[model samples]
Target: MRKTMLPVFTVIFFALGWALFSLSNTTVSQIQPRTLTLATTTSTVDSGLLDRLNPVFEEKFNAQVHMLSLGTGAALRTAENGDADVVLVHARSAEDAFIEAGFGINRRDVMFNDFIVVGPSNDPANIHNLESASEAFTRIAQTQSLFVSRGDQSGTHQKEQVVWATANINPQGNWHLSVGQGMGNTLLQSSELGAYTISDRGTWLALKDRLNLEVLIEGPVKGGDLILLNPYGVIAVNPAHHSDRDYELAMAYIGFLTSIEAQQMIDDFRIDDEPLFFADALNEQPNFEQYVPQSR
Candidate 1:
């Protein structure tokens, strides 16, 4: 009986050792080099900009960027979850708070486009050449225009909220419809419904051909709410949050995204020969970058 028990114990020990060795081999196989995960806002992806931008980075760096584009809030949540190696987003307040909290490091300002109030050709709100985004909203409110809001808690939506605040309008009643859709779909809905709306200029340009809506009013010209400035930024996700985080790839992507060549691509990318985003990442950015740097 003792010999039989001894043999069974040895067999079990060998099986456990084999299992451990197999797991170790599997772990080694899973290890990857020069790979990154990035969480970003939908605008960067939806406008088909990434489709143009990422290939260059991949070729140059010999790295892979697994990008996840969600709303600003959801993007930030990815960083918080240690699921992303980097982040590219538009919410300055949230990004600042993220860096301050040590969840993000090495932030660099990237490109930008202003928001626009778009509506049907009928000009229901009659908000063309308004000059001030706030004033345009005031006009829209007073005129009771049919406004379709993305209402998806995205960076664009955040800017819209600020514009409404500037307009000193709460925005209640029949003229408003919250679609809670992505940028492209929202544009389609606004076009199909012939409703007025506020949207990022990049998105508008990207989808302008398929949609009937035209620019009703330009939000903020340069920086102020008048410019209704929309900026994109890249930040390294703090590695402390995830031990296996790909900091090397994240840093590479940051360097690539903020590189002069990348900025030039941004400057050069256009729809129908019209510039969509003005690059603001390198030595010379738009005026907004001067005001908001990595520190403040």
Candidate 2:
């Protein structure tokens, strides 16, 4: 009995030491506090853009910019509620409204990738050759082609709203289906259903290899009458909302986003030989510092 008791006691001591070792490691990990939460859209997150960008940004900033990827609506809500330090989203109208509501500041157009209507390879809606996005929607509405909607108040959904408004049509009856999810999931659903759907060019491009759908209509080409121009923007939350948030840090990130290095990164952010986004930080308005710094 004494021998057994002694061996059991020795085992307990070894277990205690191992527990302390793990505890010390966890405590060490918690000491740095090198984390920042970025609320951003699903398209960017789902396409693993953040993963590609994070290493550079984190090494430069000496901190991790962990992302909470959601739809634009959900991300804005997170920013508004002070649940995140910064937000990267694309919906222009909603973003303007958010800033006007005193929830955000420093709106900077980071980059752009337009929305597109995708359908099965067969093109059952007969919208294959339509030059006008609105006309395509009108025809789809008329024919009642199965249309998959993100359904969530996402940037893609907002664009769809505008397109529907332009076509003077309402997505009613059995014609439209709302997936109420992120871009990747919705694309999968659209593929499975072989339906027509509007999606961000970035997400679609990233998932192109995996999906059987093809782009049916391109939104608002340059010099076109289309209203759906999907320009992504980065915004810092109002300091008044969360005094504890590192406002300066958020600003610095915005600065990086608009900087020449980051613009170059954005310009190079491509997949499968198709550029996911066009850096518009300097294209719309010529800022020498944005595209070409004085040092360069």
Q: List model 1 lDDT by residue over 1-296, tens digit each.
A: 45558789899999999999998787444545366788987888877788899878877776667889898878988888898889998877778778888888878888877888788998866777667888888888888877888887788887888878877899888887888888888889989989888788877887898998888676554433555788777888888877778888888888888788888998998877778788877663345543334475
Off by over 4 Å in 2: 1-33, 220-226, 283-296
Q: Alpha-carbon error at 259 in model 1, in Å?
A: 1.5
The backbone clash count of each candidate, in order, is: 5, 0
State the RMSD for candidate 1.
8.1
lDDT of predicted model 2: 0.82
Candidate 1 wrongly placed segments (more than 4 Å): 1-33, 219-225, 284-296
Candidate 2 residues 1-296, lDDT tens each? Answer: 45558788889999999999998788447657467789998888876667877767777877778799889999999989988889999888888888878888877778877888889998877988877888988988888888999899998999899889988888897879977988888999999899989888778887888998998777653333356578888889889978877787788788888788888988887688667777778665554432221233
TM-score of 1: 0.81
Against the true structure, what is each candidate's TM-score?
Answer: 0.81, 0.84
Pairs that clash in candidate 2: none
Best by TM-score: 2
